[model samples]
Target: MHYVTSKTLLSSNNGMNLYRGCTHGCIYCDSRSECYNMNHDFEDIEVKQNSAELLKKELLKRPKSMVGTGSMTDPYIPIEKNLKYVRKSLEMIYRYGFGFTCITKSDLVLRDLDLLEKINERSKAVVQMTLTTADDDLCSILEPNVCVTSRRVEVLKTLSEAGIPTVVWLCPILPYINDSHENINGILDFCIESGVHGIICFGMGLTLREGNREYFYKKLDENFPGLREKYVEKFGDSYTVSSPNNRELMKIFKKRTDEKGILNDNDEIFRYLHNFPQDSVQTKLI
Candidate 1:
């Protein structure tokens, strides 16, 4: 809910975060990790006042690459309905003839479908959505302020039908909470039906660090009472709080994704996401 003038926009790797903090009340958000060093409250979103202009500058100077956003914060937060920073950036990216991709959990992305379709037509545009759980009730608990799982699946399918490829981040699977076979299978079924181009799942567990770990534990105590003690006993001070069923869950994940021919390899998917497609009609830079 605050604004600051930023000097730069895109990263050396062609990624940009239009906002610094997030409003999405995800209980397992790793962006709150102490490693990031945010100066404001997590919910007090910090908007880059000059994002569109800065992005246009960056896009004009750099060679064509897949520009990405929403790494540290979701670009489609409710404020986006008014701020339109993400939409403006997409306009610049499309106008500059750069491929675009973003990771988000909001259906508000549908608002910019026109620009996304245009970018994909000129170069490439991939929309990546995160689906943590298939159960809408659990999704409300885990990623509380965003669209539910079913709605995100609808968004994915909508993007697919629009000829825009999509990727899904199936991650942060909490142990004892959402690590069962039924949960993983349900999420995987949703992905398969949505025709997602790739799925990036590091493992069947979530990471916990100094800042995020405490916040996650606090939420756990509030929601799943006494779960904090269980975590302390199981993964005292570990960063990667992996699920006990990581092996078995990963087995199901790999089998389902592989059978559906969806991209499951992280490196391969990153390559697909990062490597700017040099297709005949899409290579001309503005």
Candidate 2:
């Protein structure tokens, strides 16, 4: 890990990434795509040493609080063990009473449960987990080296029981791999059973780009030989890799989410994510 002084920490939308590049090694990671243009290796994490301090400054100046992270890269990367930057940032957010949200695949987030609960008590805290496959074996192949789907479900359940809302990203359902009807239904079942507030699934598919595509194909050749050629023949340098059963799987996804009353539309879920609720006392006065 290397430290760099960031000029600014939060984005216009109030998102912040304390670290760049990930070590979790998800085979289909989009952050590794050339479009992102990281100067360092993907595993050689770049830490924003000033992130927490800058976040404190920014939150102090803001009129309202709605800060989020873990969009471009997972905030709770393995390197966080030595850094503890994410934990410190969460402490700042809780101290300032800012609503917090993050997307991560690691159960390491449980370590900061105290700060998360505090933020949820004062404002709101949303935890979004990405679940691509229900099968542990397939999950190992697809998102190798991260926490398995079952453990992530446990995290979601634990967060839900704490009254901290949760969202699930059921995405990148690799074509011909984990795109079966049973796989989608199994994950959706877990979400509904765990009482997830919403699910963000953009159809049933994955997208491959310059850097990520090469990496994914290399993994395919190593693990699932002959699959790379099939992908090339089917997609042929295309960005989107929709499953052949996309329509059918989406039908099940929409119907099940609709039945459970979980927020299914991406825009609506995003709105829920960004919309900070006014304090109950303020609402009563108004």
Candidate 3:
């Protein structure tokens, strides 16, 4: 990892990424795509050294509070164990009394659970975990380096039990691989059983770009022989690879989450995440 002082930390949308690359090595990682124009190798994380300071400075000026992280890169990467940048930033957000949300696939996030609970108490703190496959072996092939689905489900259970709102990203259900009825239903069962507040699934498909497309196809050939040929034959150069069973499996995902009272629609979930409740704002006003 290399350090650089960033000109700004927060985006116009109130989201911030402390690092510009990830080491979790998810085969379908959109962050690795060329369009982002990350000048460094995806694994050689670009650390925004001034992130905590910049965040604190920016939060002091904001009239309202709602900050999110880990959209482009996993904030809880292994390097966070030594650097604790995300933890320090969280402390700043908590001290400033701003709501916080992070999407990650690492159990390393649990290290800051105490701070997260405090933030939730003061305002709101939502943790989003991505679950793509229920089968552990398949998960290893899909995500490669991060924690498996079962352990992530356990993390969700732990967070839910701690009174921290949790959301699940049931996405990138790779076609010809984990995009099956059983896989989708299995992950949904975990979400229901774990008591997640919401699930964000943008169709049962994965998007591929220049860098990520090559990596994913290589992995497909290595892990599931002949699958790459099938993808080439079907998708060619298309970006979105929707599963053949997308309609049926999506029906299952919607029906299960609706029955369980978990927010299922992507738009509704985004609104819930970004729109701070009037009650919380009123209390802040007081």
By lDDT, the best candidate is 1
Misplaced by over 4 Å in model 3 are: 281-286
Q: 255 in model 1: Cα distance from truth in Å? A: 1.1
Q: Model 3 over residues 1-286: C-alpha lDDT tens digits?
A: 8999899999888899988888888888887889988898889989999887888778878856678995899999999999999999888877777788999999998999999998888788899999999899988878878899999999999999999999999988888788888898899889989999999999989999898999888878788899899999999999898999999998998898888899988898888788654455323321
**C-alpha RMSD in Å of predicted model 2 compared with the true structure:** 2.8
Instruction: Give per-model TM-scores.
Output: 0.97, 0.96, 0.96
* Residue 204 displacement (Å), model 1: 0.6
**What is the number of backbone collisions in each predicted candidate, taken in the order shown?**
0, 0, 0
lDDT of 1 at 145: 90
Q: Per-residue alpha-carbon lDDT of model 1 for 69-162, expressed as tens digits?
A: 8578988989999988888888778877789899999999999999999988888999999988889999999988998999999999999999
Candidate 2 per-residue lDDT over residues 35-134, each given as its tens digit: 9889999888898988877987888888566789958899888888778888898888777667889999999989888889988887888999999988
The models' CA-based lDDT, in order, is: 0.90, 0.88, 0.87
Residue 97 displacement (Å), model 3: 0.8
lDDT head-to-head 1 vs 3, winner:
1
Could you report the Cα RMSD, in angstroms, for every candidate shown? Answer: 1.3, 2.8, 2.0
> Which consecutive 10 residues in model 1 have the weakest lDDT in total?
277-286
RMSD (CA, Å), candidate 3 to true, equals 2.0
